[model samples]
Target: VNLLFSANRWEMASEIVDDLNRGIVVVCDRYAFSGVAYSAAKGLDFAWCQAHDRGLPLPDSVFFMRVEPQVGALRANFGDERYEDVDMQVRVRERFDDPRLRQGVPWH
Candidate 1:
């Protein structure tokens, strides 16, 4: 699934580069880092998850909007997805907060 997710992004790589070259700002809701974070939370090796996304276009800026797991669970349709459980959300949050994962990225 992670490989498929990365491939999906790779399919858009050229278009993203084109837009950037033309001075158009591109925004994405989820990118490589999210893939790594989520999969890592599920017990995948962090480096292994990251390796699949290697060489993908790096975002100019990365923003992580921190929300408490319980608070997030309160949001509408929170349980609509497979990873929506509060416990899973907590694990995912910890993965995102991992310093090794954040290295070399300008995260806000």
Candidate 2:
């Protein structure tokens, strides 16, 4: 199915919301938060990354999968994914941990 090959596709998220609105208990494997975090990790503007997903139904709960970078890289390497590269992974980790994203931190 096209959906299988298009796992990271953002538009699929809208379809998911549509399903939920129709009383489907649609559970997303990765949703806007993950998309925003990953893309923003790659230097995308955080707000711009989120603009497309604005007003989507918020999840009733979230389960953050916290894993150490070393573990993540090993998992990624097994699949031949370069995103597990040590330096790049560190940047992605930093992107998530950066306090600039926290409330009350001045962007200026």
Candidate 3:
């Protein structure tokens, strides 16, 4: 499913490219980071998650914010979804903080 999620992103590649070409900024709620972090939290290898998302178009800027567990739960409205729990989010956050993920990206 993680691989498929990464693949599915490319399904909209042309449109995203076209929009960028037209000077429109694109905002993706979930990008490679989320794909990797979420799946990795679910027990997938972190490296494998990163491997699958390689070569995708890079964003001009990325903003990664980690909130407190209670904050995240409030923002996500706890129990409304499977990943809204504190435990899952903590795992996801840890994976996102992996040093490997910072090697080549401009993180703000």
Candidate 2, superposed: residue stretches over 4 Å from native: 1-15, 97-108
| Reference-based lDDT, residue 83, model 2 | 59
Better of 2 and 3 by TM-score: 3
| Ranking 1 against 3 by TM-score, winner | 1
Sequence-dependent TM-score of model 1: 0.96
Name the weakest run of 10 consecutive residues (lDDT summed) in model 1: 96-105
lDDT of 1 by residue, 1-108 (tens): 899999999999999999999999999988998999999999999999999888888988898899999999999999999999999999999999999888777999
Give a tens-digit lDDT track for model 3, residues 1-108: 898898898787778999999999899877887888889899988898889778778787778876877687776457688787889988888888888876677888
Model 3 clash count equals 0
After superposing candidate 3, which stretches have Cα over 4 Å from the reference?
A: none
Q: Which ten residues in a row have the lowest lDDT in candidate 2?
A: 99-108
* Candidates sorted by TM-score, best first: 1, 3, 2
Number of backbone-clashing residue pairs for each candidate, in the order shown = 0, 0, 0
Between candidates 2 and 3, which one is better according to lDDT? 3
The RMSD (Cα, Å) of candidate 2 is 6.5
